[model samples]
Target: MASLNVYSALVVLFFTRAAAMATKENDQIIKDNNCETKMGLPCVLEAFTSIFKTGTISSKCCGELVGFGKVCHTTLVKRTLENPLFKDLSPARIIVKSIQTWNICLALIDSPSPSA
Candidate 1:
C-alpha cells in the first residue's frame, strides 16, 4: 500500500511538471507571435464565445480572427483548454470546434465582398 501511494505521488508530480512546461511553452509562443494584440477585445470575446459556447461569430470578427493567424489561434485555444476553469470541457470537442471556427473564419475572409 505504501509503495502504491509513493508511485501515485510520483505520477502526480510528473504530470504537474509536464503541465507547467506546456504552459510555459504556450506563453512563449503567444509572446513570440504577438498574439495578444493581434485581435481587438471584442473580436477575441467573439472568438472565445464561438468556440466555448453556443455563439455565432460576426463577419467582422471573422475577418479579424483570420488576420490573427492560425498559429496564434490554435495556441490560444490550447492554452484556454489547459485552464482549470475549463476542466469539465471535453478537449476533443473543443478542438473540433476550434478547427471549425477557424475554417469558417477563413472562408468568410477569403470570399469576395459584394460591391455597393
Candidate 2:
C-alpha cells in the first residue's frame, strides 16, 4: 500500500509539472501573437497616416496586418481596439480594409503573367 501511494504521488507530480509547462508554452504563444507586439500601435498610426499620401501598403505591413487578423480574430480585435488607447480608431474598418487589401495583393501575386 505504501509503495502504491508513492507511485501515485510520483505520477501526480509528473502530470502537474507537464501541465505547468504546457500552460507556460500557451501563454508565450499568446504573448507573441498579441496585437500590441505583432501589429503595434506605432505601425498602425504610421500606416493610417501614410495611406492618404502614398495610396499603398508595403508587403511587410500587409503581412503584419494579416497576421494580426489571424491571431486575434474579429471579436478579440474589436474588444482590444475598444481600449482607450484606440478609442479614436475604427478597428472594424481597418480590419476590413486590411483584409480587402491583402486579398487583392494575394490575387495579383497568384495571377498568371501576360507572357505565361
Candidate achieving the largest lDDT: 1
| Candidate 2 TM-score, C-alpha based | 0.36
Clashing pairs in 2: none
lDDT tens readout by residue for model 1, 7-90: 999999999999999999999999999999999999999999999998999999999999999999999999999999999999
In angstroms, give how far residue 88 of model 1 lies from its true place: 1.0
Give candidate 1 regions above 4 Å deviation: none
Task: Please give each candidate's TM-score.
Answer: 0.95, 0.36
- What is the alpha-carbon lDDT for the whole of candidate 2? 0.57
User: Per-residue lDDT for 56 in model 2?
Assistant: 65
